[model samples]
Target: MVIRHGQASFGADNYDKLSDLGHQQSAAVGQALRDMGWVPDRTITGTLTRQKETLASMGFEAGEEHAGFNEYDFQDLLSARYKGDVPDLVKGDRKVHFRTLRETVFQWQADEIENPAESWGTFTGRVESARLAACATGADRVLAVSSGGVIGQLTAASLGAPDKMMMTLNLQIKNTSITKFVFTNSAFFLHEFNATPHMMSGEAAGMLTYS
Candidate 1:
């Protein structure tokens, strides 16, 4: 299971932290997994604070910390794309921000943007390495906590989708949602993508967040 970090401090000075709703969503995920009798024997998380916090909120102790699972810096991408000055509206409004982000990522994938700390190729390679290492543990169930960017790219790659598909996938992946991959015969196959069984019904349904 690969899960996106919960609702983050979007539009804040520090977007690395989880919001209150994020905590609730994480806890709900934990309960939902337990109810399904799908507990994992091993867990891994990106080195980001939000990823670590999400793992904790899900009632799991800290597991392995891998920088390969870390998200590519969107702020850095925007800065590189805009040559350092992003428009105020893009920074302030959620809709505008996402729209701009999608376009920027598209450009980044096409090698149109430059100077980002990590290039598109670098990001993808790192994620692939992380996935391989995580699956190498031979655990029956391995849960990984990561950001949408990493998950999106992984999902797209798994489907043999074009480079631009990651942008679309990234935009729609909900917080704390699970994407399952089965690694066997030295290969990883996608079993599911973007499932939120936890918030399927009841008041928890209102907790779904795509950001």
Candidate 2:
């Protein structure tokens, strides 16, 4: 099962750290996975603090996290895309800026944008490589903890289209959500997308979010 890291501490430069609620969410997910009789043979997580913290909270040691699972720095990508300025508008009025940026991201996914920080071709290639590497480990069940962007990229690849519509659909993937994929001999078959069965209760229900 591929799990996205839980809610992160908002408004922090290092968005890789989980918030108090995020930790609780991670623990809940862990418990749910255990209840489902899913014990992974191996585990992998990004180099980011949040990814590692989430796995640890999930009761997985996941020694020596892999850099292959690490997310591309969107901030750096955005900075480069806009010629290193990353307009104050994005920082000054976050809500509006995010909406605008989301549209731009969608365009990028569609290959409509004239220039993007990282091409969709490159992004998909990296994600595919990571998936191949994970499968090569020959583990029966493997767990990977990563971010929304990475998850979305993989989701799009599984769907065989990394276009704007796919990007928009993937954007709806929530925090701590589980998307299962079966791998054999370097091939990936999607089992599920954005499953949040553990958050059925009221307390846990609040843990649902797409960002």
Task: Using lDDT, give the best candidate's number.
Answer: 1
TM-scores, one per candidate: 0.98, 0.86
Candidate 2 to native Cα RMSD, angstroms: 2.5
Instruction: Name the candidate that leads on TM-score.
Output: 1
- Residue pairs with backbone atoms closer than 3 Å in model 1 (clashes): none
Candidate 1: stretches off by over 4 Å: none
Per-residue lDDT of 5-115 in model 2, one digit per residue for the tens? Answer: 988865677777998888888898999999999988888887899999999998888754666567655665566557678777775565765576676676566676555
Error of 1 at 197 (Å): 1.1
Question: Candidate 2: lDDT over CA atoms?
Answer: 0.77
